[model samples]
Target: MFKAIATAAFASALLLGASTANAMIINGNFEDTATLDPTGLVNGNKLSNLATTGSSWDVFTQINGWTTASGAGIEVQTNRTLRSVDAHSGQHYIELDSHPRPNSNSSMEQEVALDAGKYELSFWFSPRNDDASSNGIEYSISDDLVSGFITGPSVSPLTSVGAWTLVKALFVVETAGNYTLAFAATGKQNTLGGFIDTVNITAVPIPAAGLLLPAGVALLGFASRRRKRA
Candidate 1:
Protein backbone atom coordinates (compact mmCIF):
# COMPACT_ATOMS: atom_id res chain seq x y z
CA MET A 1 0.00 0.00 0.00
CA PHE A 2 2.82 2.42 0.83
CA LYS A 3 4.59 1.72 -2.43
CA ALA A 4 1.40 2.17 -4.45
CA ILE A 5 0.67 5.56 -2.83
CA ALA A 6 4.21 6.80 -3.46
CA THR A 7 4.11 5.73 -7.10
CA ALA A 8 0.76 7.40 -7.64
CA ALA A 9 1.95 10.64 -6.08
CA PHE A 10 5.10 10.70 -8.16
CA ALA A 11 3.18 10.07 -11.37
CA SER A 12 0.78 12.88 -10.57
CA ALA A 13 3.66 15.24 -9.96
CA LEU A 14 5.27 14.39 -13.28
CA LEU A 15 2.01 14.99 -15.16
CA LEU A 16 1.61 18.40 -13.57
CA GLY A 17 5.12 19.39 -14.48
CA ALA A 18 4.66 18.37 -18.11
CA SER A 19 1.38 20.25 -18.45
CA THR A 20 2.80 23.46 -17.07
CA ALA A 21 5.70 23.30 -19.48
CA ASN A 22 3.37 23.81 -22.43
CA ALA A 23 3.69 27.19 -24.13
CA MET A 24 0.34 28.99 -24.54
CA ILE A 25 1.27 32.04 -26.59
CA ILE A 26 1.89 31.85 -30.32
CA ASN A 27 3.50 34.25 -32.79
CA GLY A 28 5.45 35.87 -29.97
CA ASN A 29 8.18 36.72 -32.45
CA PHE A 30 5.91 39.20 -34.28
CA GLU A 31 7.03 37.49 -37.47
CA ASP A 32 3.53 36.65 -38.69
CA THR A 33 2.48 39.98 -40.24
CA ALA A 34 0.42 38.90 -43.17
CA THR A 35 -2.55 41.10 -42.26
CA LEU A 36 -0.57 44.31 -41.89
CA ASP A 37 -0.82 46.94 -44.64
CA PRO A 38 2.57 48.57 -44.91
CA THR A 39 1.37 51.26 -47.29
CA GLY A 40 -0.74 53.44 -44.96
CA LEU A 41 -3.15 53.56 -42.05
CA VAL A 42 -6.54 51.83 -41.99
CA ASN A 43 -8.01 54.95 -43.55
CA GLY A 44 -6.00 54.14 -46.72
CA ASN A 45 -4.00 57.36 -46.37
CA LYS A 46 -0.28 56.96 -46.81
CA LEU A 47 2.18 59.05 -44.79
CA SER A 48 3.48 60.46 -48.13
CA ASN A 49 7.22 60.39 -47.32
CA LEU A 50 8.14 58.07 -44.46
CA ALA A 51 11.87 58.23 -45.31
CA THR A 52 12.00 62.01 -45.09
CA THR A 53 10.18 63.60 -42.13
CA GLY A 54 8.36 60.51 -40.89
CA SER A 55 4.60 60.00 -41.26
CA SER A 56 1.86 62.26 -40.03
CA TRP A 57 -0.83 59.61 -40.34
CA ASP A 58 -2.23 57.85 -37.29
CA VAL A 59 -2.97 54.13 -37.60
CA PHE A 60 -6.15 53.41 -35.64
CA THR A 61 -6.58 49.79 -36.57
CA GLN A 62 -5.18 46.29 -36.28
CA ILE A 63 -1.83 45.09 -37.54
CA ASN A 64 -1.95 41.32 -37.95
CA GLY A 65 -3.12 39.89 -34.61
CA TRP A 66 -2.33 43.09 -32.73
CA THR A 67 -4.73 46.03 -32.42
CA THR A 68 -4.40 49.68 -31.51
CA ALA A 69 -6.18 49.73 -28.18
CA SER A 70 -5.52 53.42 -27.49
CA GLY A 71 -3.75 56.48 -28.83
CA ALA A 72 -2.71 56.67 -32.49
CA GLY A 73 -2.56 53.46 -34.53
CA ILE A 74 0.53 51.27 -34.71
CA GLU A 75 3.04 51.52 -37.54
CA VAL A 76 4.54 48.50 -39.33
CA GLN A 77 8.06 49.25 -40.56
CA THR A 78 10.32 47.41 -42.95
CA ASN A 79 14.03 48.05 -43.53
CA ARG A 80 13.48 49.03 -47.16
CA THR A 81 13.63 52.87 -46.98
CA LEU A 82 16.63 53.04 -44.64
CA ARG A 83 14.28 54.20 -41.90
CA SER A 84 15.03 51.15 -39.72
CA VAL A 85 18.51 49.76 -39.32
CA ASP A 86 18.29 46.15 -38.10
CA ALA A 87 15.23 44.17 -37.03
CA HIS A 88 15.68 41.98 -33.94
CA SER A 89 14.68 39.10 -36.21
CA GLY A 90 12.87 38.55 -39.51
CA GLN A 91 12.32 41.32 -42.07
CA HIS A 92 9.53 43.18 -40.22
CA TYR A 93 9.05 44.89 -36.86
CA ILE A 94 6.72 47.39 -35.17
CA GLU A 95 7.38 51.10 -34.60
CA LEU A 96 5.42 52.44 -31.60
CA ASP A 97 5.48 56.10 -32.57
CA SER A 98 2.86 58.47 -33.97
CA HIS A 99 5.58 60.71 -35.44
CA PRO A 100 5.11 64.18 -36.92
CA ARG A 101 2.50 64.49 -34.20
CA PRO A 102 4.15 65.49 -30.94
CA ASN A 103 2.88 64.37 -27.53
CA SER A 104 0.72 61.77 -29.18
CA ASN A 105 0.44 58.37 -27.51
CA SER A 106 0.25 55.20 -29.60
CA SER A 107 -0.57 51.78 -28.21
CA MET A 108 -0.58 48.26 -29.63
CA GLU A 109 -2.11 45.18 -28.08
CA GLN A 110 -2.92 41.52 -28.66
CA GLU A 111 -5.41 39.25 -26.92
CA VAL A 112 -4.22 35.71 -26.20
CA ALA A 113 -5.97 32.66 -24.86
CA LEU A 114 -4.54 31.71 -21.51
CA ASP A 115 -4.89 29.05 -18.86
CA ALA A 116 -4.90 29.52 -15.12
CA GLY A 117 -1.23 29.67 -14.20
CA LYS A 118 1.74 31.93 -13.69
CA TYR A 119 3.54 32.89 -16.88
CA GLU A 120 6.81 34.59 -17.76
CA LEU A 121 6.63 37.05 -20.62
CA SER A 122 9.56 38.52 -22.52
CA PHE A 123 10.16 40.76 -25.51
CA TRP A 124 12.78 42.94 -27.20
CA PHE A 125 12.47 46.73 -27.33
CA SER A 126 14.47 49.67 -28.63
CA PRO A 127 14.17 53.46 -28.85
CA ARG A 128 14.10 55.41 -32.06
CA ASN A 129 16.78 58.03 -32.65
CA ASP A 130 14.09 60.68 -32.77
CA ASP A 131 12.59 59.48 -29.50
CA ALA A 132 12.29 62.13 -26.87
CA SER A 133 13.89 61.73 -23.47
CA SER A 134 10.57 62.62 -21.89
CA ASN A 135 8.60 60.14 -23.96
CA GLY A 136 8.31 56.48 -23.03
CA ILE A 137 6.31 53.25 -23.28
CA GLU A 138 4.50 51.00 -20.79
CA TYR A 139 4.12 47.22 -20.78
CA SER A 140 1.03 45.54 -19.41
CA ILE A 141 -0.55 42.13 -18.92
CA SER A 142 -4.31 42.13 -18.80
CA ASP A 143 -5.23 45.34 -16.93
CA ASP A 144 -2.18 45.09 -14.69
CA LEU A 145 0.74 47.29 -15.64
CA VAL A 146 4.24 45.83 -15.57
CA SER A 147 7.11 48.16 -16.53
CA GLY A 148 7.70 51.61 -18.00
CA PHE A 149 10.77 53.05 -19.72
CA ILE A 150 11.88 55.87 -22.01
CA THR A 151 15.59 55.28 -22.55
CA GLY A 152 17.36 52.77 -24.78
CA PRO A 153 19.63 52.57 -27.81
CA SER A 154 18.32 54.67 -30.67
CA VAL A 155 17.63 53.17 -34.10
CA SER A 156 17.78 56.34 -36.13
CA PRO A 157 18.61 56.95 -39.75
CA LEU A 158 20.73 59.97 -38.94
CA THR A 159 22.82 58.78 -36.00
CA SER A 160 24.68 55.58 -35.12
CA VAL A 161 22.19 52.79 -34.52
CA GLY A 162 22.15 50.42 -31.54
CA ALA A 163 21.00 46.87 -30.86
CA TRP A 164 17.68 45.86 -29.35
CA THR A 165 17.24 45.29 -25.62
CA LEU A 166 15.24 42.47 -24.02
CA VAL A 167 12.45 43.18 -21.53
CA LYS A 168 10.84 40.58 -19.25
CA ALA A 169 7.87 40.37 -16.88
CA LEU A 170 5.82 37.91 -14.83
CA PHE A 171 2.04 37.73 -14.34
CA VAL A 172 -0.59 35.36 -13.07
CA VAL A 173 -3.91 34.36 -14.59
CA GLU A 174 -6.50 33.19 -12.10
CA THR A 175 -9.05 32.26 -14.70
CA ALA A 176 -8.98 30.77 -18.18
CA GLY A 177 -9.87 33.42 -20.70
CA ASN A 178 -8.56 35.80 -23.30
CA TYR A 179 -6.05 38.17 -21.75
CA THR A 180 -4.63 41.32 -23.23
CA LEU A 181 -0.90 41.86 -23.59
CA ALA A 182 -0.38 45.52 -24.40
CA PHE A 183 2.33 48.13 -24.95
CA ALA A 184 1.37 51.79 -24.64
CA ALA A 185 3.44 54.83 -25.53
CA THR A 186 3.48 57.53 -22.90
CA GLY A 187 5.10 60.87 -22.10
CA LYS A 188 5.66 63.55 -24.76
CA GLN A 189 4.95 61.45 -27.81
CA ASN A 190 6.65 62.33 -31.05
CA THR A 191 7.58 60.50 -34.23
CA LEU A 192 9.85 58.28 -32.15
CA GLY A 193 9.17 56.36 -28.97
CA GLY A 194 9.76 52.59 -28.87
CA PHE A 195 10.25 49.59 -31.10
CA ILE A 196 9.13 46.03 -30.28
CA ASP A 197 10.12 42.62 -31.64
CA THR A 198 10.40 38.93 -30.73
CA VAL A 199 7.68 38.70 -28.05
CA ASN A 200 7.63 35.39 -26.08
CA ILE A 201 5.43 33.89 -23.38
CA THR A 202 6.14 30.72 -21.41
CA ALA A 203 4.76 29.03 -18.34
CA VAL A 204 6.84 29.47 -15.22
CA PRO A 205 8.51 26.19 -14.32
CA ILE A 206 7.34 24.60 -11.09
CA PRO A 207 10.56 23.60 -9.39
CA ALA A 208 8.91 21.39 -6.78
CA ALA A 209 7.52 18.99 -9.31
CA GLY A 210 10.64 19.22 -11.50
CA LEU A 211 12.83 18.18 -8.57
CA LEU A 212 10.46 15.36 -7.61
CA LEU A 213 11.10 13.33 -10.78
CA PRO A 214 14.64 12.22 -9.94
CA ALA A 215 13.84 11.82 -6.27
CA GLY A 216 10.81 9.70 -7.07
CA VAL A 217 12.90 7.44 -9.32
CA ALA A 218 15.49 6.99 -6.59
CA LEU A 219 12.82 6.13 -4.06
CA LEU A 220 11.40 3.53 -6.39
CA GLY A 221 14.81 1.96 -6.81
CA PHE A 222 15.31 1.83 -3.03
CA ALA A 223 11.89 0.21 -2.59
CA SER A 224 12.78 -2.48 -5.13
CA ARG A 225 16.02 -3.26 -3.28
CA ARG A 226 14.15 -3.65 0.05
CA ARG A 227 11.63 -5.97 -1.62
CA LYS A 228 14.48 -8.14 -2.96
CA ARG A 229 16.15 -8.27 0.46
CA ALA A 230 12.85 -9.22 2.13
Candidate 2:
Protein backbone atom coordinates (compact mmCIF):
# COMPACT_ATOMS: atom_id res chain seq x y z
CA MET A 1 0.00 0.00 0.00
CA PHE A 2 2.86 2.37 0.81
CA LYS A 3 4.52 1.60 -2.49
CA ALA A 4 1.26 2.19 -4.29
CA ILE A 5 0.95 5.57 -2.60
CA ALA A 6 4.50 6.40 -3.64
CA THR A 7 3.71 5.42 -7.23
CA ALA A 8 0.69 7.62 -7.30
CA ALA A 9 2.71 10.51 -5.91
CA PHE A 10 5.43 10.01 -8.49
CA ALA A 11 2.90 9.86 -11.33
CA SER A 12 1.27 13.04 -10.18
CA ALA A 13 4.65 14.73 -10.04
CA LEU A 14 5.43 13.63 -13.58
CA LEU A 15 2.12 14.91 -14.83
CA LEU A 16 2.82 18.26 -13.25
CA GLY A 17 6.18 18.43 -14.98
CA ALA A 18 4.70 17.71 -18.41
CA SER A 19 4.16 20.71 -20.67
CA THR A 20 0.96 21.64 -22.45
CA ALA A 21 -0.02 19.93 -25.72
CA ASN A 22 1.92 20.64 -28.92
CA ALA A 23 -0.46 19.21 -31.51
CA MET A 24 -1.06 19.42 -35.18
CA ILE A 25 -3.85 21.43 -36.95
CA ILE A 26 -4.26 25.09 -36.21
CA ASN A 27 -7.07 27.61 -36.60
CA GLY A 28 -9.48 24.94 -35.44
CA ASN A 29 -11.71 27.73 -34.21
CA PHE A 30 -11.36 29.80 -37.40
CA GLU A 31 -10.07 32.68 -35.28
CA ASP A 32 -6.57 32.87 -36.77
CA THR A 33 -6.96 36.02 -38.84
CA ALA A 34 -3.29 36.85 -39.26
CA THR A 35 -3.60 35.24 -42.69
CA LEU A 36 -7.03 36.15 -44.14
CA ASP A 37 -8.97 39.37 -43.90
CA PRO A 38 -12.73 39.09 -43.28
CA THR A 39 -13.69 42.71 -43.78
CA GLY A 40 -12.84 42.61 -47.48
CA LEU A 41 -15.74 40.17 -47.87
CA VAL A 42 -18.37 42.79 -47.03
CA ASN A 43 -21.52 41.47 -48.74
CA GLY A 44 -18.78 39.46 -50.51
CA ASN A 45 -19.05 38.66 -54.19
CA LYS A 46 -22.29 36.68 -54.19
CA LEU A 47 -25.00 36.27 -56.81
CA SER A 48 -27.92 36.06 -54.37
CA ASN A 49 -26.64 37.39 -51.08
CA LEU A 50 -26.42 33.64 -51.17
CA ALA A 51 -27.74 33.92 -47.63
CA THR A 52 -30.99 35.57 -48.66
CA THR A 53 -31.59 34.00 -52.10
CA GLY A 54 -31.05 37.25 -54.03
CA SER A 55 -27.75 38.73 -52.85
CA SER A 56 -24.02 38.33 -53.57
CA TRP A 57 -21.04 37.37 -51.42
CA ASP A 58 -17.26 37.50 -51.91
CA VAL A 59 -15.01 34.46 -51.91
CA PHE A 60 -11.62 34.53 -50.23
CA THR A 61 -9.29 31.72 -51.25
CA GLN A 62 -7.18 32.13 -48.13
CA ILE A 63 -8.35 30.79 -44.78
CA ASN A 64 -5.76 30.37 -42.04
CA GLY A 65 -5.67 26.55 -41.74
CA TRP A 66 -7.92 25.48 -44.65
CA THR A 67 -7.47 25.03 -48.41
CA THR A 68 -10.01 25.38 -51.18
CA ALA A 69 -10.53 22.02 -52.93
CA SER A 70 -13.15 23.11 -55.49
CA GLY A 71 -15.35 25.95 -56.73
CA ALA A 72 -14.26 29.60 -56.94
CA GLY A 73 -13.01 29.88 -53.35
CA ILE A 74 -14.09 29.79 -49.67
CA GLU A 75 -16.89 32.04 -48.50
CA VAL A 76 -16.59 33.54 -45.03
CA GLN A 77 -19.26 35.74 -43.54
CA THR A 78 -19.77 38.02 -40.59
CA ASN A 79 -23.00 38.98 -38.79
CA ARG A 80 -23.03 42.05 -40.98
CA THR A 81 -23.92 40.25 -44.18
CA LEU A 82 -26.06 37.57 -45.83
CA ARG A 83 -28.45 35.82 -43.46
CA SER A 84 -27.00 38.08 -40.79
CA VAL A 85 -26.73 35.00 -38.65
CA ASP A 86 -24.22 35.08 -35.82
CA ALA A 87 -21.28 32.68 -35.88
CA HIS A 88 -21.44 29.56 -33.76
CA SER A 89 -18.43 30.70 -31.81
CA GLY A 90 -16.18 33.47 -33.03
CA GLN A 91 -16.79 36.49 -35.24
CA HIS A 92 -16.65 34.43 -38.45
CA TYR A 93 -17.85 31.19 -40.05
CA ILE A 94 -17.77 29.42 -43.45
CA GLU A 95 -20.28 29.04 -46.27
CA LEU A 96 -19.33 26.26 -48.72
CA ASP A 97 -21.12 27.65 -51.83
CA SER A 98 -18.31 30.18 -52.55
CA HIS A 99 -18.02 32.16 -55.77
CA PRO A 100 -18.66 31.93 -59.55
CA ARG A 101 -22.28 32.61 -58.61
CA PRO A 102 -25.49 30.49 -58.79
CA ASN A 103 -24.09 27.33 -57.23
CA SER A 104 -20.35 27.23 -56.74
CA ASN A 105 -20.64 23.80 -55.02
CA SER A 106 -17.46 24.46 -53.10
CA SER A 107 -15.21 22.22 -51.06
CA MET A 108 -12.68 23.29 -48.45
CA GLU A 109 -10.22 21.09 -46.63
CA GLN A 110 -7.31 21.10 -44.24
CA GLU A 111 -4.41 18.65 -44.14
CA VAL A 112 -3.27 17.32 -40.76
CA ALA A 113 -0.27 15.24 -39.76
CA LEU A 114 -1.37 12.63 -37.29
CA ASP A 115 -0.10 9.46 -35.69
CA ALA A 116 -1.80 6.08 -35.69
CA GLY A 117 -4.72 6.40 -33.32
CA LYS A 118 -8.42 7.09 -33.05
CA TYR A 119 -9.38 10.65 -33.74
CA GLU A 120 -12.67 12.51 -33.62
CA LEU A 121 -13.77 15.35 -35.90
CA SER A 122 -16.31 17.90 -34.69
CA PHE A 123 -17.99 21.07 -35.89
CA TRP A 124 -21.13 23.18 -35.68
CA PHE A 125 -23.40 23.19 -38.73
CA SER A 126 -26.38 25.27 -39.72
CA PRO A 127 -28.37 26.12 -42.80
CA ARG A 128 -28.17 29.48 -44.50
CA ASN A 129 -31.70 29.04 -45.79
CA ASP A 130 -34.83 27.08 -44.86
CA ASP A 131 -34.46 24.74 -47.86
CA ALA A 132 -33.29 21.41 -46.50
CA SER A 133 -31.84 20.07 -49.73
CA SER A 134 -29.53 23.03 -50.26
CA ASN A 135 -28.19 22.75 -46.72
CA GLY A 136 -26.59 19.33 -47.12
CA ILE A 137 -22.87 18.88 -46.46
CA GLU A 138 -20.75 15.77 -46.59
CA TYR A 139 -17.61 15.63 -44.45
CA SER A 140 -14.86 13.14 -45.25
CA ILE A 141 -11.46 12.38 -43.83
CA SER A 142 -9.30 10.58 -46.31
CA ASP A 143 -5.65 9.74 -46.79
CA ASP A 144 -3.64 12.74 -47.85
CA LEU A 145 -3.99 13.13 -51.64
CA VAL A 146 -4.23 9.89 -53.70
CA SER A 147 -7.99 10.42 -54.16
CA GLY A 148 -9.17 8.11 -51.40
CA PHE A 149 -12.67 8.33 -49.92
CA ILE A 150 -12.91 7.80 -46.19
CA THR A 151 -16.52 8.29 -45.03
CA GLY A 152 -16.42 10.01 -41.69
CA PRO A 153 -18.35 12.72 -39.80
CA SER A 154 -21.85 14.14 -40.33
CA VAL A 155 -21.72 17.91 -40.03
CA SER A 156 -24.70 18.56 -42.24
CA PRO A 157 -26.60 21.75 -41.56
CA LEU A 158 -29.99 21.62 -39.85
CA THR A 159 -33.20 23.28 -41.06
CA SER A 160 -33.48 25.84 -38.28
CA VAL A 161 -31.73 28.56 -40.23
CA GLY A 162 -29.30 30.09 -37.70
CA ALA A 163 -29.74 27.20 -35.26
CA TRP A 164 -26.32 25.50 -35.31
CA THR A 165 -26.15 21.81 -34.55
CA LEU A 166 -23.07 20.11 -33.19
CA VAL A 167 -21.87 17.08 -35.18
CA LYS A 168 -19.11 14.57 -34.54
CA ALA A 169 -17.54 11.52 -36.19
CA LEU A 170 -14.83 9.16 -35.03
CA PHE A 171 -12.34 7.40 -37.30
CA VAL A 172 -9.06 5.55 -37.01
CA VAL A 173 -5.73 6.31 -38.65
CA GLU A 174 -4.15 2.97 -39.55
CA THR A 175 -0.63 4.34 -39.89
CA ALA A 176 0.98 7.66 -39.13
CA GLY A 177 0.88 10.04 -42.09
CA ASN A 178 -0.72 13.20 -43.42
CA TYR A 179 -4.50 13.11 -43.90
CA THR A 180 -7.02 15.33 -45.59
CA LEU A 181 -10.05 16.51 -43.56
CA ALA A 182 -12.54 18.01 -45.98
CA PHE A 183 -16.07 19.48 -46.03
CA ALA A 184 -17.99 19.90 -49.27
CA ALA A 185 -21.42 21.19 -50.09
CA THR A 186 -23.90 18.50 -51.11
CA GLY A 187 -27.53 18.31 -52.26
CA LYS A 188 -28.78 21.23 -54.37
CA GLN A 189 -25.54 23.24 -54.21
CA ASN A 190 -27.56 26.39 -54.66
CA THR A 191 -24.75 28.59 -53.28
CA LEU A 192 -27.11 29.69 -50.55
CA GLY A 193 -26.51 27.54 -47.42
CA GLY A 194 -24.48 25.01 -45.45
CA PHE A 195 -22.62 26.85 -42.70
CA ILE A 196 -19.69 25.39 -40.77
CA ASP A 197 -17.86 26.73 -37.77
CA THR A 198 -15.79 25.74 -34.74
CA VAL A 199 -14.24 22.93 -36.77
CA ASN A 200 -11.92 20.75 -34.66
CA ILE A 201 -10.17 17.41 -34.88
CA THR A 202 -8.49 15.75 -31.91
CA ALA A 203 -6.96 12.40 -31.17
CA VAL A 204 -9.20 10.25 -29.04
CA PRO A 205 -8.17 9.18 -25.57
CA ILE A 206 -4.84 7.33 -25.53
CA PRO A 207 -4.87 3.56 -25.90
CA ALA A 208 -3.48 0.94 -23.47
CA ALA A 209 0.16 1.91 -24.04
CA GLY A 210 -0.66 5.40 -22.89
CA LEU A 211 -1.74 4.18 -19.48
CA LEU A 212 1.23 1.82 -19.26
CA LEU A 213 3.84 4.51 -19.75
CA PRO A 214 2.91 6.49 -16.65
CA ALA A 215 2.45 3.29 -14.70
CA GLY A 216 5.96 2.18 -15.66
CA VAL A 217 7.40 5.47 -14.47
CA ALA A 218 5.41 5.16 -11.27
CA LEU A 219 6.79 1.71 -10.55
CA LEU A 220 10.36 2.89 -11.02
CA GLY A 221 9.81 5.84 -8.78
CA PHE A 222 8.17 3.67 -6.11
CA ALA A 223 11.14 1.30 -6.17
CA SER A 224 13.59 4.16 -5.75
CA ARG A 225 11.51 5.57 -2.91
CA ARG A 226 11.38 2.20 -1.22
CA ARG A 227 15.17 1.89 -1.37
CA LYS A 228 15.57 5.34 0.14
CA ARG A 229 13.08 4.61 2.92
CA ALA A 230 14.81 1.35 3.76
TM-score of each: 0.63, 0.65
The window of 10 residues in a row where model 1 has the poorest summed lDDT is: 218-227
Tell me the tens digit of each residue's lDDT in model 1 across 34-143.
Answer: 44534465435443333234543335366566777876677655444234354566644666766437545788888888787666566666666644463356777765
lDDT of 2 by residue, 99-157 (tens): 55665888888888978765556566667775666677777777522221111123321
Candidate 1 clashing pairs, residues 3+ apart or interchain: 59-73, 99-191, 103-189
Candidate 1: segments with Cα more than 4 A from true spot? 1-27, 35-39, 42-60, 81-84, 100-103, 130-135, 145-150, 153-161, 209-230
lDDT of each: 0.54, 0.57
Question: Candidate 2: worst 10 consecutive residues by lDDT?
Answer: 218-227
Error of 1 at 59 (Å): 4.4
Give the C-alpha lDDT of model 1.
Answer: 0.54
